[model samples]
Target: MTASSLTRPSSKASACGCGMKRRAFLRTTFAALCLPSLARGNGPSPLPSFDRCLEHFMAARNIPGGALAILRHGRLVYARGYGWAQREQQIPVQPTTLFRLASLSKPITALAILRLAQARRLSLDEPAFDRLGLAPLPGKTRDPRLEHITIRHLLQHTGGWDRAVSGDPMFMSHPIARACGVPSPPGPRDIIRYMMGRPLDFDPGTRHAYSNFGYCVLGRIIEAVTGHPYETWVRRDLLTPLGIRSMRLGRSQLRNAHPGEAHYYMADNRTAPSVFEEVPSVVPAPYGSFCLEAMDAHGGWLASVVDLMRLSAALPGHGGSLLTAEMWQELVRPPAPPVARDAHGRLNDMYYGCGWLVRPIQTPPGHNIWHSGSLPGTFTFWVILSNGMAWAVLFNQRREANGLPDTEIDGLLHLAAAHVQEWPESDEFPRYYRPSS
Candidate 1:
């Protein structure tokens, strides 16, 4: 679609407002144009059947609810909710419904660190432990490599700990709490102390293995440098300027659920030992199977599709990115002599850059950057296409038996995008959105 076609008049309506005049006009116009093209066999149809695509996928996969938002050429072209947000309560998944972002939290945290770096408050190459005012825990074998671990290493997932061998220390909430002499569910600080006493899985910066603990350490570094909680600094420095207000760190207990947050549904509906001993014998995995609060930097964020899109719009290519152009370049630049590759010896098309996954596109002038987040009850996917398009999809229930739901959703989005002959000229943000309180 042409850029002019996507332009829309701005509005000041509340985010949760139900202004549907533009929506109705676009639907009617889109349908009318598609009918003539089919009858004349003029060319491929331009109409994107997003609703049908999403409905079919949700039904086939048994997904209770989801929300989708799409932006083309830096303008929101499609934003809608499907199915239920809270099945038991009969709450529909509107654009305003909050859902756990899981690991997508890393990108937000990474941006905060980059912001600090831009301000000269911290250096990316400095030894992270020294900067954080932390030393190896007293009784554990001190790996000399720990001293060489820099903030860059942590951001790149090269800080040494590997989940395949030593296990992800972030997920071992109970053991970390017990070993650190704390309560049942240890927080980020406790987890860091527990891991510091352990040996590195590999020498720092030698290999690339995805590590949630690495991001956890980055969060600590943010706190150490800023003297403020990670979330607080992020809100002030990164999100506030972007007009995002509702995103917040999620709580593990259902009772503490944020207003308008979707209810989680695990396929098994099984319970695990409570993270808090004082609680019931068991609780739903999303609520207490592990400590969501402790997973703050890596996986504990709750946000709506609108919140995520706002972040995407602020990234480097979208013209309104928060970081300076120089800093933004540094954030996306792949490590020199790229160390990541797959078994076939082909240069891995996709590699982790700062917080997001980077995949170079041969056909497109720019690369694609995206992230996927999955937990017991949540599955989320967000992408910034090389063509200046971005979108986010979030689901309350994840299917264990079905093939990877995010991958299927990814293809579905591409299919829908391919069929779009025209994009709405007006943004629906103000009419249909209600800012998170």
Candidate 2:
């Protein structure tokens, strides 16, 4: 269906047999789903108003470009693009237009590690450095805690590097390069070497702090175990198996942009020094201010909304085809207690599982899994509801003002889902899956 059709009422009547308007029926059904008793009923929950709600949300936020895709029971129900992928050229965003996944790259990397474990290539509980045939970077005061860091710790963001205090080591490209005797912008391996010599912010597994460096280390571990580049292995093993062809590691320069990639925009229209000194003095933040290539496992993949939803569907909760059943259970399993509690001393509503953040619901179906990613000029959010429904939204411009943009998106999506009454039976995947010229 066309983007315009998403806002109009369908000719088909409500399947609920009440002769109710599609929108009203959807709103009522979704409201019922919120109740614990009705949640487990084997009824359909379609999101028909998704396109209209997303269009309104983007316009209100002045988002330059975006793509959204929704899935029901692993089937594509809604997929559309909005605004302009390149405003200067008047290029409208298409469903196939690729946008940077940003930190969403973590989940993909986490999947790779889990797959490796399934193949008996590595153990999650083993010391990561030992498995990689490396040692912690030598520091003045040797901290024995480094030896306790495991693959599971890195996946759960409990590897001890706190961005709040010591800052994200992944962004310290120049300093890492200088310290490791690498080129001006250090690669993942060089960054790992530089961080090894430093003391961890806290004891391993003591607390959860988002760490890009931890995933960067995971990338290297993938390389070490497979004896192949992280991207090469992921593309060959994880993505291609699911028929995802366009996802790949992104570049830091527009000139190096992959085919069908959208041009990124910053909210302030500001530029920063390029990661490569030899390049232009200043470049768009998404294009070159940071080294995306070095950000391999943490935040560097570029993908279309369709591809992301496909990945989501392949995940365990939604009857995924990727990991084995046992592996899937392990992926969503929460860290063992005394589980880390929030500041209020209450159990966190959500905890970072292997790669995704999981929030268990008191109602039926148990839990929901999701991941949100952001970089200088990109914002992406992916969520898989407990009832085998999944959706993903990717935007080229990320607004960095007061609160988190993705959190607002989560609210908007909930509103949209609640308002949806009838769903289009036709799948738009075949129509928009191919790249546009």
Candidate 3:
């Protein structure tokens, strides 16, 4: 693809964000991705401490751009974009700029399935492969346990295929595509058929192991049940209703990036073999190294940090508009034994819920749920605390200069939240969204 094709959406005031003067916007920088502590009220910055922490962290890592958004009691207390959306083009990362969500997309997929179940369209206990009814690609042995896999198992990452034993089929695009006789990168159905030929890493639901392909299957399940493509059903039924219009499944190549999407940057200038091309060629890991399209159900959505918090705002307790209080309660309940507890039958402090990681907190009297997503050029972390505080952090670069994991941002936010003297009373919801009642 040509460099011209790698460009972002038009920079019109209506198309992009606040057409704030470029020179004026940069004045908010305080080193790193200096996004000045900004709020809608135009009063004092909501969280200068948060700005310092985020900025210092980004500067230390040489990250190009990022965004942070916080919500309290369904109100957007804070939202800001740091550094550049496109460093070379001098496009600043706006609060509305889109970023590839990586594994964070899992939570949204889980939400869709839960919505379907709530509406009595499908049951979580229903057999997944039986529902799809696709034959395994002609292979020597098909795991009988595969038929036993359920929708709940897929949501909880308990489906049989373990990346350690069988290798993550999500990344093996080229070989799977060639084997399946499809395009360069195989789609969800093709990947499922490829897995049918291989033995499962373990029995369905016996253990807890993260599986990207499991959610890939969930996307297919959504299609079979809804009579629509995965993205179409999700956007029309779930996201659009919740005032999340810009969220969409992203592409593996930069040439196909959506309008107003932030340009991705690599850590330490890393490069990898392109997954989109028929013949292997080196490309930036964020763009062509892996197939984002094939990872749609698991980690393929692009969204602004604000849109993500809007999702939080719509959930039960926050706004009591999207999900009922009961669904929210059930969403955090741990999976059946061995997955939720240790060998001795003791409950573990942290466990995987439907999509988010769950940890019970005694002080808050409710559980805190969180999830993080990472790809070649993306690193994102978000947590919904038990005390009704939720924050999302997104970066165009996946790693710091020292090679530390992106999850480090979680700790920084934890400290920043602890230090918050007072959260802004102003809410961005009224200004930013128009959710249907």
Candidate 4:
């Protein structure tokens, strides 16, 4: 794809989310394309109002480091980094800095499923367990209701597992590893077999509950159907075609943090029993409390805010580069029955749809779709709206010093943009971060 073709207003979209080939982008951009404008001497950016808002939010929480990129109608308008990415070594966060994308992985996995469906590789209504054809763990009995769970139920988070009631199995790495008779941090297939033996919290497709294990199974399903590893298929068929080059599954240890990845911090400065060991041992909660490798489909991605914003803008609804218009609408439509109602909302405005949190609006005649990610030391947010505006912000710490929640960024970003007297006519996508082709 040419530089002009990437950022220009064009409606050419692929039936499946495949466009740019990786071979065409054999030459990579020198790490950070926006370093001159974003990271080097952050003095007077074009959007100083946004800079102030982000800086204030970080200062109030004493957040170690963060990076943000904003897009309007598929054009990157602003990109910046703030504070130290590694405070101990004085490494500054850059627009290209990669952070663990907790639940934001859901949207990416969900989009992959939609793309596969668009290609007629799978059906949403197909029984998930039937499709995988994997057996339950040795000697354990299978739940009959497991046969009824469908791909749509998993995508909608209407699958039976409820983290609040039954406790999230994805976090129980040690126990699962023990049960599956495998090494510490068992892979996705072992996790799925272990889950198969347990009874679900509720019947499938009856209600909505966010599930990490559900997406984990989706990962294994992708592997089973495509005859390739989940990461291999996603990069080859989904991400590369979308012009995303740097994203990949993250590892659990600090030493394993991907190159250009930010180090993590905890606000409480607490530790937990390392999931990798049977003996009682404490490690930094962010680095060893859970197994990121096990959370591949739901929350294991490492990426920069710039790459995430590119994904948001390149998605079907925003730039028409992924699924067809009909499947895009199908992607957002809330399922029938009680699943349509919001789980935590006071009104009937927002609900979980496929991979995103959906809020239908009146004036725009479309919906606002977004997803947030949370882990021991990471908090990330991505938003794609109907008005052709999108923003992605990522932090190295999950908590704040002032007792403020991570979700606070949601409102502050909106307010900052609304208060802006003017937005630049420039498109940063091409000038700042477009990879060499």
Clashes of each: 8, 4, 0, 0
Question: In candidate 2, what are the lDDT values of residues 174-281, reduced to their tens digit?
Answer: 777777666767887777767777888998888888888899999989999999999999998888877788999999888888888998887788888777867887
lDDT of 1 at 104: 83
Mind giving the per-residue lDDT tens digits that candidate 4 earns over 1-437? 00001111112221111232333211111111112333344466777656766776677678889988998877888888889899999999988888998999988899888888889999989999887878899899999999899999999889899988988888888888999988887878888898899989998988878888899988888887899999999988877876788999999988778888999998888799898765347898898889898898999999998888878777765775778887788787877677765566334556777888777767747877888888888988888877888888899987645545566566556655655678888877765344535
User: Worst lDDT window (10 residues) for model 4?
Assistant: 1-10
The global Cα lDDT (0 to 1) of model 1 is: 0.75
Q: Which residues of candidate 1, in runs, are more than 4 Å off?
A: 1-48, 342-346, 362-364, 432-437
Ranking by lDDT: 3, 4, 2, 1
Best first by TM-score, ranked? 3, 4, 1, 2
TM-scores for candidates 1 onward, in order: 0.86, 0.85, 0.88, 0.87
The regions of model 3 sitting more than 4 angstroms off are 1-44, 278-280, 435-437
lDDT of 3 by residue, 361-415 (tens): 7763777787888887888876777677788888898764564435545555655
Off by over 4 Å in 4: 1-43, 278-280, 342-347, 400-402, 432-437
Model 1, C-alpha of 151: deviation from truth (Å)? 1.0
lDDT of 1 by residue, 137-239 (tens): 5676667878999998998888889899999887787888878778888888888877888889988887888899999999999999988998898888887
lDDT of each: 0.75, 0.75, 0.78, 0.77
| lDDT agreement of model 3 with the native | 0.78
